[model samples]
Target: MITLDSASNNNTAMEELEELFIEELMDLLNGIPELTVIFSADESAAELKEYAEALQSDPVGKSRQIVAACRASGQRRADVKQIIVDGNRKFLWQPGGTLRVVQLLRDCETRWSSTYLMSDRLLELYPAVQCFLNHPQQTQIAHLLFTTPQYQLLHDIQTILAVPHAAQELLSAEKTPTLSAALPAFEILLESWIDLQTKLPMLSHYIGVGIVKIQEYAAKGRKTRAYALAMSIVILCGVTFIS
Candidate 1:
């Protein structure tokens, strides 16, 4: 079985490979009747990445605005970084305290997780950000400052994306990784989004989009015999161990 990311080029390549496998390789593989080639996508990682990009690309999205404002100018970036450094010094001066200062992260288009990391860091240094924005010399960019409600929205975004992020990490683990974890991860993602929809009504649109994407991938995964067989093996192992 071959697993590929959900890229247009990868999709095209998979299709071509499938056609080749059926037309030319099938006859050759006929001697090995039990052997089969299965092509699977990196389910959770792709879905979560796409979901993050969607949030950032939405024209009306506050996430997009916040990111844009932060990245608007090099000077502004430097200022924010300086503020964080200064804040770290003060924090470390306190008795029995250690500095945990992190530079503000900028998101990259190629890696979706960067968006989450960026938001996480921005929220972490929010006080420094406010101080920078409210500075007398920084008045020109003062309009870029996020409101309390906007910051809260960003917090909500962080909370909502954490579920899928953890699932992606689990599926992509380097140690004793199993594809058998895929279905459970997807189910957890779907349930998490569904629950978030009710709890964060203001974010229903984003949550709805996430739910649909999860369902689509889950359905495609369920249709594959390998998925079912893997899940069955896990269940049987559990039952045997219990017995």
Candidate 2:
């Protein structure tokens, strides 16, 4: 027989949900398992080190400045909006149309994938963006043009982040993921990240820092696995003694 429990950490809403609904199901079944598989790292803390939030800070801030400049004028904003729309239309109708043009995606604090998608889309729209900013009508927003360093930063951020984004996609499948999958996936992810540093010399610093963070999390995972194994052995010994 398998027992499943829906317990939560200290979040107030989750606590309330667990008390109200999850507890009812737990009572109906029996109780939760002593050890539950924890998938994924604590994102709130781990994200700062693993992802491009740090790398993209300047670019995102610069992008926001562009938004602010465009919003300052109705005509400027309209022109910018029209440019994006035209790009989308061109994307669909152009003879050698690559793919559908994705809109400017906002990065969410909670979702790392949003950062990747946002950077990717921004890179795709770079040429159109350059034209719009350089246009005489867009003189006010000219100062907001993305710089060489900023473009390079976004490119590096997207490449390094793609690995974790892919891993997250694999782990978050609708089907139940096994605990064994985490370690191997992480190992491969770690190696890929390390290899990226060598390939992109400019990105070496961020990738190096990220590798250290991943190692820390991997160490914690190993300890948690060892502790669980020890406890399981102890429980088995107790069961044999009782028998």
Candidate 3:
């Protein structure tokens, strides 16, 4: 075992000896990439490439902005929350209405899963929200509510992100896992994405770009694995011959 703590080595002779070992170890690993580099390569190769920038990206951010602007921007005096509550309450009490009232869920910056929940809730409450904004009492928030195109954008985003959000939740469990679990999960995701290509053209384009980058990294991983297997076989053969 080696100790690198400066305070633990008070002896002058030992300090000089430790410096020599440190220098030799550094020279020995001079060409090796750091852990951060290896981790980044793995991220770029895996499904992580799909959501690496999701926190700051437009789909999640823009959806949040649209909802927030309803209460804070444009005419600015409307109690958007009260309007939604009243509208949903009215709808729930209406004849032939059996569904429970659902409130809009805001996305929290620290919780990534909230983005998907927010979009899903917005879509579910769309009709009620539209009704509230259109009513005479909701003058201020009407213009602030998302326009037709903006709502469409949010819907598409929510639909596409559902897959990743579900996968994230499934993967985040604390249970012990194996490498074999990843391929099936990724295959399912890829198949679902391929089916959504026509339904979500914009999302398809973004996914296509990420797929290209991931493919390049995956090719590199394959070559590395092949080389390692070959080296292992050669080493085993030599060891057997020596024995």
Candidate 4:
């Protein structure tokens, strides 16, 4: 019924109003301390305030609330529209399309968490270990040695500690007895891993934490490859540092 793309006189006017409303909603959504402004064809201040407050409790809850309220308030379907995003919720909507009704919501802001990021980063470092260790002479592993300044020392410590855990993983996976990570013979040079850890803020603390985590996770999973991989990284780091 509502065609914003129409070339007709009345249709053009309605389309302009809809465009204005949509732009306003986008502005309110993007603003810091996020603003919730509701618009309606009737231009009822009380209704707008009520809708705003309802959204504040659960921004996307407007689906059920707005639909039910509109019915009671004698508001038509075309009278209202809202664009609600949970901080980072992504979607694309166009004017005069199917009604977007919110059923449930969660504030989708990604927490800048040190622990989660550190763990994820360590996992990312896993694949490179084998490459560096296998061909220490040919590979350039200096970049892989240190953590960025963004991390705490705890992250670094975890990285250093991950080697032993990775080693343990291999030992557990092997149908036959395998090498131990802590054994003096097996403790390959960890210069690169140490270098990476030192780049982080709280180097010593994060390294301590990382070591403990590697110990924990390495206990269950296949670790032979993990051990060999870790050993390779340690050795490569050491070799790269020497040169």
Candidate 5:
């Protein structure tokens, strides 16, 4: 069994290894006729990470601008953190304080979930971010402040990315990683993106693209016996538990 990421080099390596296993090793070890090599890729991680990178490069929308603004804001995390904390403190001492202070999150280039987290935190602290940037002393980064429409676009981007982000997190469970979870996660992501296409017309193009990418990966995953067997075992366990 071989597991790899969806890189071109890895794909090439898998193909060559499979050929070796079939043409050379199979004959050499003819006694082990039932033996076979299982080649699997981390489709969930690949899809989410590639989708984020592709979205950032898309020319059709303000996603790139929104990400850039968030990245710029993160560059001044200390100042933003102080602003949010002070604002929260003001409400804390008030009669009916309901505000919770949230620090601005910075996205890592390699992780799609971080991008979602940063965008989510930014949207959550929108008012505080605006106030911080609007201050006279903060004029340097004032230009990085998001406009009303840009904020809406940012929200849309966040919404679109949420499905895959959640799927990635679920599949990345530290204690109970299971292949049975992959197909369902892909299905959920496909359903969410298709639904988003209808709900967010402005992002229909990107969402449509995402739907196709997920479908492609899902189809590939369905061909794997390990995935099928894992899902079957999960179903059996569920039935037993219910009974």
Candidate 6:
């Protein structure tokens, strides 16, 4: 359900924007280059007006200041990037397993990824955080959140359950019992991270709860359908035997 929109205002607007991908399970959206800001001009209008007036007076200075900040401390290409997502404005570290994928998500946006949890102010500042977890490559990682309804998370955890054991075999000093499998251990780490994040109440919501209930109903329906099919098969077999 997430769609990536273009943030470009003109021919020169696209740089990293071209890196966006719309893979099977991912949705991303871009915003206008500069005008997406949600300004609160209510009581603060006087000060806000003053600030804009200053910017208007010295637009070149404002540009230079931003450029200076980036050049002075540019870490955009690093494996780990910090970004504000929604209202929480959480500091970020790439999940160790998928740093490259993290970078892609960190710079992207998705409408369906639920940035509503983020405040407008935070979103305004870092519009790319919402889709960070939804990139196709990180889809499996995102499912690691217990609040998610999808089974891919558990499936992914199961996939990596033997990583520690594998690591043990690789170690020299008497590779004892392989420690543990690497994959599931990684899943455990992911689970812990996500669980800790949700506990922060500010980011907690009923979405996962609702998804779980939906899954339960779907499971029940499948079971009921299977039972009916089995009954129909038995009846047909008996009738054929009589013939």
Q: Whose lDDT is greatest here?
A: 1
How many clashes (backbone N, Cα, C below 3 Å) per candidate?
0, 0, 0, 23, 0, 24
TM-score of each: 0.59, 0.57, 0.52, 0.21, 0.61, 0.18
lDDT of 4 by residue, 12-56 (tens): 222232233334434444453223333333445434343333323
Estimate every model's Cα lDDT from 0 to 1: 0.59, 0.54, 0.50, 0.34, 0.57, 0.29
**For residues 1-243, what per-residue lDDT tens digits would candidate 1 score against the true structure?**
112232233323222322332334234334444432321244543443333343333312444455566567887777777776777777732443423455566655555455666677777666777777789986876776765544665677678767866776677677533567787778877788888889986456656766776788878998999877876787777732221
* Tens digits of lDDT, candidate 6, 1-243: 111122322211111111111110122112332322344344443343333333223322222232233223245323114432222344232332222222221212432111221222122332233343344544543432222211222222222222222322342235232112222333443454356346432112222332343345434545675545644665665632121
Top-TM-score structure, candidate number: 5
lDDT of 5 at 54: 36
Write the residue-wise lDDT of candidate 3 on 111-196 in tens digits.
54565687687676566666666768668656646655456655665665566555555545564341223334445555676778
What is candidate 2's lDDT per residue for 100-214, written digit by digit as tens? Answer: 4344555455553554565576667666667678998777668877666557755665677678767666656664433434556678788998899899764565466667767
> TM-score for model 4?
0.21
Please say which candidate is ahead in lDDT: 4 or 5. Answer: 5
- Candidate 4: Cα lDDT at 93: 27
Q: Which clashing pairs does model 1 show?
A: none
Location of the lowest summed lDDT over 10 successive residues in candidate 5: 1-10
Order the candidate numbers by lDDT, best to worst.
1, 5, 2, 3, 4, 6
- Model 5 clashing residue pairs (backbone): none
Q: What residue runs in model 5 are displaced by over 4 Å at the alpha carbon?
A: 1-79, 89-98, 232-243
Q: Determine the backbone clash count of candidate 1.
A: 0
Q: Give me the overall lDDT of model 1.
A: 0.59
lDDT of 4: 0.34
